[model samples]
Every structure is written in C-alpha cells, then in structure tokens.
Target: MMLRIPLNLGLLLLLCAGGATALAPAEATGAPCGGLWARCLESKCCATPELTCYEKDHRYAQCRPTGNCRPGFHHEDPVQTPWSCVVLTSPAPAPGPGPAPPPAAPAPPAPAPAPAPAPAPGPAPAPAPPPPPQQCVDKGQHCVDWAMAGECEKNAAYMHEFCMKSCNLCGNLFTNSEEGTAAAPAAAGDGSSNHAAGSSNAIDSSLRGGR
Candidate 1:
C-alpha cells in the first residue's frame, strides 16, 4: 500500500553531495550562544572555543577564557597576552545594592589639672654684722710716766707685762722674757753703785766738820 503526502516547496528535504536526499540539522540561531564573560547554564557552552564556560556555583556560572586566567582579572587579546590568560573579573548581578555602615559618635574634651595658688612674699632681710673687737691698748694711764721714770728698770716683771706700749713691748703682753733680762740686772747694778758713791760723799762731809 502507498501512503501519499503533499510536499511544500519551502519545507523541501536537503540533498547530499552523494546525490541522495538527507534530513537537515537545526538552525544555529535556534538556541542562544554565550559571548565572552556572559552568563551560562549547566551546558557550559560559549560562542567561541577561546571563550569557554565555567560554573562558579549551582546558582552562578559564566562564559570566560579557556586559558590559565581565573576570575577577578583580565588580559589583552591581540597584544601582550596573545597566548596566555590573566584573571577575569566576574559579571555583576541584576539585583539592587546593600545597606551602608553606621555613623561614628563624638568624643568629649579633657580638663586641666591643679589650679594656680597664691605666691608668698620675698625672703626676710639678712642680719647686720657684729661690731669689730677693740684693738690692743695699755691698761693704765700711769704706764707712760712709770716707764719714763725708769720704774720699768726696777719693776720689770710688772711694767713689761702690763705697760707693754710704754715699755716699748707692745704686742708682747703678759710676757717679759727679753726685756726683763736686760732691765732687771742693769737696775740692780746701778743701785749698788749709787749707794757706794753716797757713802763716800757722807764720809767726806763728816771729816770736814771735824776739822
């Protein structure tokens, strides 16, 4: 039995180089092909073999370079990286943006330490200096008269020590070592000579009276 079917000119079957009729393949534009860095599906197919497909996760995947370059980077096609690949940044999402951070709080000022105190008056004046001590002076006013009357020769111990200025022994107070040695011996010798001379004069006077 022969099954009859009407043929349309536009839907005609394709012919092969072998002179035989064959079924035609589906059109290329029938299913969409991804471009470079374009979103992809589980099939992971791309428009060109240089641009391969990769699945980032179950929900996210994209078409990227088949070279060593990973995500978050890029490279030049015909220049420096003609054969190799660098990192390729992923495509952005279609959703809205996220929220921002909170604002910072203000700080307080620091205070000053110890307050200024009142200063005291200046220091007290220094004390006055004491009066200078008296210089060396003779003890008695009769010192000069006694020294001149030759009392120093008779009483050398007292005169030389007490009447130092009159005895010409000033600054040698209370001392009679040298002056006494000279005066004492000479006074005793002179007194003996005067006694002898007076005795002779008395004898002469007595003899004249007898005559």
Candidate 2:
C-alpha cells in the first residue's frame, strides 16, 4: 500500500501556497478590481490584505486588522465593521443673499379732533328805574309837592278867581249863594232866645243899681 499523509495537512499546505500567491505585488493594470476583495485607493485598485480595505476615489488608503472590513464593502471573511470616509464637498458662494426685507409697519391711527367750545351766555337785562315825582309849577321852579295839599288849595283859589272874572261864562252865582245861605242857617242854630237872655242876665249881674 502507498503511504498517505492526512488530507487536512495537505489542504493546509495548499492554503499557505494560495496566500503567498495572493500577497505577491501585482503590476498596476488600471483595470477595475472585481468582487469583495477589491477596494480603490488613490483612484487605483490594490489587492488589500485580509479584512483591510479603503474607500474609492479617496486620497488615502487604510488597512485594518483581520475581521475588520469597511462598511458598505462586501467581504468574504464574514466580518461586519464600520468605515469612515470623507464626505462629498460643495463650494461656498461668494456672497449670500441679503437679509429678507422687514415686514411693513402698521399705519398709526389719526388723532381725534378737539371739541368746539360752547358759546358764552349773553348779558342779563338791566332793571327799569322808577319814574320821577310829578312837579307843581305854582309852588316854585324846582318844588315838586308830593303831598299836593298846598297845590290843591292854590288850584281851588285860582279856579274861584277865574269864575269870578268870567261871571258870564260861570252863569250860576245866585244858585251858589242860595246854597251857601242854607248851609249857614244849619250851622248857626234856629233863634236861641235863651242865649240872648243869658247874655242880658250876665250883663245885669255884672252891673249894680244906680243911686
């Protein structure tokens, strides 16, 4: 029988040979490296070691330990890990738009007009004064007799003289005298002989008989 080493040892030898082959530096082909083992470093594809990878179109390359692969990159090693990369960039503008215009201000309300002043009241009417006393011409130039007694007597006397002077105009002098005579008798008392006798008696009593 031919002598046979264990199949596991043979497989290990084959794997070590494959690893050596994979680690060998290759000429840059400028061709896209395909499959999970590929990564782009500095715009080129480089055969990375197990679990090491880098971002595409980046300036730098990164190498990680075994079982650490970049995120979003497939790996045949069954390792899930996080990767950091440069974010895309955009240029800042020269001058930004100016600040928005301020909102319009509300208009102020109009002031109320002043009320008109009330009119002033008119002046009160003046009280009327009492009339002056009547004057008598005959009394004096300035004399005004309020009692009128002297004025009345003078008026009666003047009327009498006026009637006497114009007797023809007056016409009833006899009738006036007759009324006066009747009034005198009533004043004197009828024929009092007692009064005359009393007077004689007084005279006789006053005298003594002649010798």
Candidate 3:
C-alpha cells in the first residue's frame, strides 16, 4: 500500500534537514580578542586607548601617553589605530572554551626499500710484467753517470746499485777496476754500446761457464 504524506509535512522535513546542515547554532562570537579577533589583530593594525598604535602582526606596540593615557605600553587593536583607540566599554568575561586545538598532523609515510647493495669489488688488477733487461741496463747507466757528475751521496749509492744489477744480469760486472770504469762511461755516452757490450758479455760468459 502506498502512503503519501502531506506535501507540507515533507517540505518541513526537508527544510529541517537543510537548516541543520546549513546553520550551526550561533557559537559565542567569543571574546573580543578571541580567535578571529586575534587573527584580525595579527593581520592588521590596532590602537589602544592610550593613543598608541602598532602593527598587529608584531603582537604589541608602544603607546604614547596622552593627557589621560599610559605612556610607552603595548596595545593590541582590531581596527586602524589612533581613531580606533577607545577604552573598553565592559570587561569581556573570560572565555569558557579555550582556542580550538589545532588539527592533528598526519603521520609520515614509511621509507622505500634501500638501494641494492653496490656491485662487488672489481676483479683484482693484472700482475705487472717484468721490466725489460735493456731498460734495467739503461737505468744502471744513468745512475753511474749521475754519480760521476758529483751528485749527492744518496744518488751515488742508488746509481751504483742500479748499474751493478743491470751489468751483472748481462754478464758484465761493474767494478772500480779499469774495465768497469771504461765500460761505465761508454754505457752512459751511448746506450747502444752498452747493449752491444752486454750481448757480447752474455755470449762470452755463457761460453766460459760464468754465473
């Protein structure tokens, strides 16, 4: 069975629902220096009865004393100052409810997975090849020449060691003897000569069964 309510009653129900949604009961306009008032003071300038003016954003201002005012004091105002300066008509009772609590902040999201482990250490470096015999021989010659040029003791020692090793390997021992001295100069003056001598010595030493 279909039951139809009176049009007036239906309309009244709708109006009631709309009124509930659209109009919240008048909350107390709140203390004069309440939320909106505080915000307004924060956003604009205000003056106190003492004929002092200051920026609302700064919170307080110095008020110069008039004939009937306090001198050098902070004042908060809702509107433009000087003209707006007026004694409070009546003390506003302390507000029953404090400022509405600020909205709760949202929680932070979890961090993403850490990046994959870095690639494994690269392969071990290749072993270096042995230096050429000729290069070693050349180093020895440079050492000897530097010594003969009156270089420092340390340099002389190094050169002596280098040349001896180079010459010995090629079966030509470097000594203070006449042969060693002559050979040292020849090796320094021309590397080709040292190589030729080293080659000949190597063959001769081999034939003579030398170390």
TM-score of each: 0.22, 0.19, 0.17
Candidate 3 TM-score to native: 0.17
- The list of candidate 1 runs beyond 4 A from truth reads 1-90, 93-107, 115-126, 133-211
Lowest lDDT block of 10, candidate 3: 28-37
Which lDDT tens digits does candidate 3 get at residues 172-199? 3346466775566566657756777999
Candidate-wise lDDT, in order: 0.58, 0.43, 0.48
lDDT of 1 at 41: 55
TM-score of predicted model 1?
0.22
Better of 2 and 3 by lDDT: 3
Tens digits of per-residue lDDT for model 2, 3-71:
355677788899999987776434334434322434445223333333334442344334333344345
lDDT by residue for model 1 over 1-211, one digit each (tens)?
A: 1333323332343223323322212332243557887766534466765675565444445677665445443354322222222222333323566676677776666777778787887898988888884444567888866865677779999887777666666435534577664564466557767887999999999999999
Cα deviation of 110 in candidate 2 (Å)? 2.3
Q: Which residue runs does candidate 2 get wrong by more than 4 Å? A: 1-103, 120-123, 128-131, 134-211
